[model samples]
Target chain A: MMNTKSLYQEVILDHNRKPRNYGVLDHPSHHAVGHNPLCGDRLDIALNLENGQINNIAFQGESCAICKASASMMTAAVKGKTRSDAETLIQEFREMAMGERDLNHPHHLGHLTVFSGIRDLPTRVKCAILPWHTLHAALNALSSVSTEADNDPVQNAASHPEALNRQANS
Target chain B: MVSANATLAKVTPRINTILDTDKIRADFPILDIKVGNKPLVYLDNAASSQMPQQVIDRLVRYQTAQHANINRAVHYLSEVATLEYEHARRRVQQFVNAQEDREIIFTSGTTDSINLVMHGYGRKFIEAGDEIILTTLEHHSNIVPWQMLAKEKGAVIRVVPINDAGELDIDAYEKLFNERTKFVSLIHVSNALGTINPVKQMIAYAHQQNVPVLIDGAQATPHMTVDVQDLDCDFYVFSAHKLCGPTGIGMLYGKAALLEAMQPYKGGGDMIASVTFEETTYADIPHKFEAGTPPIAAAIGFGAAIDYLCSVGMDQIAAYELDLLNYATEQINEIKGASIIGTAAHKTAVISFTLDGIHPHDIGTLLNEDGVAIRTGHHCAQPVMQRFNVPATSRASFAFYNNKTEVDALITGIRMVQKVFL
Candidate 1:
């Protein structure tokens, strides 16, 4: 009751209101889609990877303000950064969203600190972090296709063929 | 002769007395509890309504006293369970105003009910060129079964479009039904949009074309009176749990003649009369469809629910619910950047709305803090959400037990969401 309004800080609202990297960009390179089937949130992420650096990024489709703003911020943050660094930031951001780290007590995890409060509510956790997950999956898929790297999938889904089939379909 | 305490009671009066909000609140024991450090204001009735003590007690009573498999038994417990089980079927017949008791066949839920029809009827009658018509308002439950059936039988699936208000284009639906249209199946009430579709009209239109209709009443039965005979629908299906009955119990009411003609959906113990291994004959209309052991205890509980609904009367329930629906929609419309997806003039309490910028999942969580529970996301109507060009929607569905106070709480929840995101 102590003004939950503060959770929607100016930066967050600004990012939502007039999102940077908004609309679909021309001649996209790394294009991927994110689906939140539970709540029907779908987003398409596209960007140009100039050499190893994510140069120009853009997205299309619709979602809640947090997801759109988060996507916007993500695209802005990753532009001009190396793919390796972007990958690390995605990991760090995931940790912050899981409440392992607080924004006030963090280094190397700068502006992504805006999302640290999302972990307080378990259900909303997915909404707050869907864009980040999408980015990671898209980049991972991009990297997998680009370099044809086969990383070890630490978790085994051998018992569930239906789930594997679903992933395959997705 | 009027007493102050009785007047102040929250429980709805059995007699024709005006309902008091405070009194009505006391009847539901769970309403007084807290979730996330806030008093629970459950508005997720479209997903499932909270069970009343009467329905819960019947379940317990069945488990304790009459815990025996019904039908094909000669023991005392079996007699009692069989009496109760058949009584449940009679109750369901009365609930939907079906012509005969034998028309009701117990199933898992609405989804299973639709599958029963598709596999049984669709397999038998529909050919390669026949079509099954659905609308954008359909839940995935109503959509997938027909899709599967069409795929299996070499039939096609045609979709009816919806306008900006989330109302189905009935003209388009009528247009889709022609010589090739073998059957029409649709949601009587939209779980996501809350549009109380004109199933009676749909039925009449399909009938003119000699096309049988199967209406998914999962979202409809709780709020309105459904008379299969009056509606002239070929088949109707609903889940008992949505109407305060136990989960895993539902009824598929098929016109006896159609059910008799359709091939048995599943062939097994109860559904067979004689088996020669080469030429096996199916049982009667209902028994032919029921196969295996049905949820006897849950069916008994469902009977209790029917009794409870009758006590309150469907007409009165429908009137009060319409009041709540109008109030909720009116208040939500006042919130800027909040868009209601389904604007069908005739609707139930289901309100699917989206705040311009906030994710529905976030809205659901913030609303939870205020003790108002609503369903968020696509609500299993992902295709419908896609039609509206939105990712998801925060849905609040109401029941007869809900009132202005709960509706007020819902508004306050939305305002809080607005404050948080805006």
Candidate 2:
């Protein structure tokens, strides 16, 4: 059996209890609400992107521990990165969470290795990557992200494992 | 010799055949399986129930020997299948005490049953500016369909509020009915909170105002006997799977006169008497509502499930489950920071609860490690959660087959969850 303890490590709990950048943005250039209808977890991602870089990124919503932790880690990780670099970091993180990449050799996802054990718990894989997918939609300027969408980004993650791997290796 | 006599004395009180749960548990084979290393303690019966071997055997018998299309063939298998299907309808009629067998219309499940009434009755009779009375305790299945009809027909929906204890306010429900009231659809028992609504009195009041009432009995039929005749509800709906039958089959019990007044919900093969390119004449009562080749084997399995429940008796089941609920409530209340959501004066064998500082999902995950199954979410009744000021709840619902030992396991599992969070 895979270790559930690894999935809910101390760092994850810390991030959940005192989440970083956990509020609304005043006037954001990019914003999107992500919803998982299965558990009624709704997350709104808002960022002020200036000069092709994320000036500030914050999120506000109600979600489970995994989602809340992932969103907090995401905002802290991508706040100083350019939009293109942020997208690349998201791809790498997706590959790691999907177990397509080894945790020992993560490219740029620093503290996000706390979620590497998510792939073993299939149902919770959605919770772990919900905010990252929402970030992807926000960077693309889509108004919303939904598991119910016909072409959901979550589905894309499962369908395009090779793409995630290619982006991770690059 | 002395020890043997003492053992007999200890076991004498638990030997009542009316609620012979030890014997009843042996009938369900899946109950013996282990989840991890721990024995499986299934408390998610409200979401769906475990099937007994009798129902499984009946399904196998239908598929092995009695598989054929009904009403369209002259073959022996077709006739046998048709007889079994209609026999299942009669069984449902007797179970619910409906006036006639023809009044039982088989659909996919409870959601499908409500959607049929929305399309068949609401679309036909409900006009613009009319009012439909619904309660806050309704499952989304009952709420969404009416909201769609209200949106399309320009009709208005008046919601009856519930008290803090999750019981519907009877005075508020009476006031909601006015001259514009065309219909009322209410849940007989709340699936989320397990509060058995005062449906009989509500039905009587609706009858006085000359409004037809539909009762969503999906949560009620499994826990108690539902008599559509005694309640005098115009329509009653429930799913088979919630009562230890197969999925993809449910029955809608509507009064014959009201059923005849409504239009057919779907147009297809079995539902039509004759079909031409110009016009199609629909079939009689139940057939007009049930379109296409229905879930035949499932219907037979539903009959078998009803037989199984009748053998044990619903009243016995109700009594045993109430004892289980009280034991579990008392045990759970001992945990520090544990709070139960629904505290209605009257309820079935369901307990929705929350622990301080631990998310419901986290609690559910930890409980799964102990092989104790409970549902954690809004329970498909977001309105109930919202009204209770909770985002979600962990619900452990009981069935007749459940024992006191399982409730002890649940309490231990909840304590483990709290310990991890603490």
TM-score of chain B of each: 0.94, 0.96
- DockQ score of each predicted structure, in the order shown: 0.37, 0.34
Computed on alpha carbons, the lDDT of every model, listed in order, comes to 0.78, 0.87
lDDT of 2 by residue, B3-42 (tens): 3234434545455343667778999999999987889999
| Candidate 2: segments with Cα more than 4 A from true spot | A9-12, A24-29, A48-55, A102-106, A142-170, B1-18
Pairs of colliding residues, candidate 2: none
Instruction: Please report the TM-score between candidate 1 and the true structure.
Output: 0.84
How big is the positional error of residue B83 in model 2, measured in Å on the Cα after superposition?
Answer: 1.1
Give one digit per residue, the lDDT tens place, for model 1 in B204-232. Answer: 98999998999999999998888999999
- In model 2 chain B, the worst 10-residue window by lDDT is B1-10
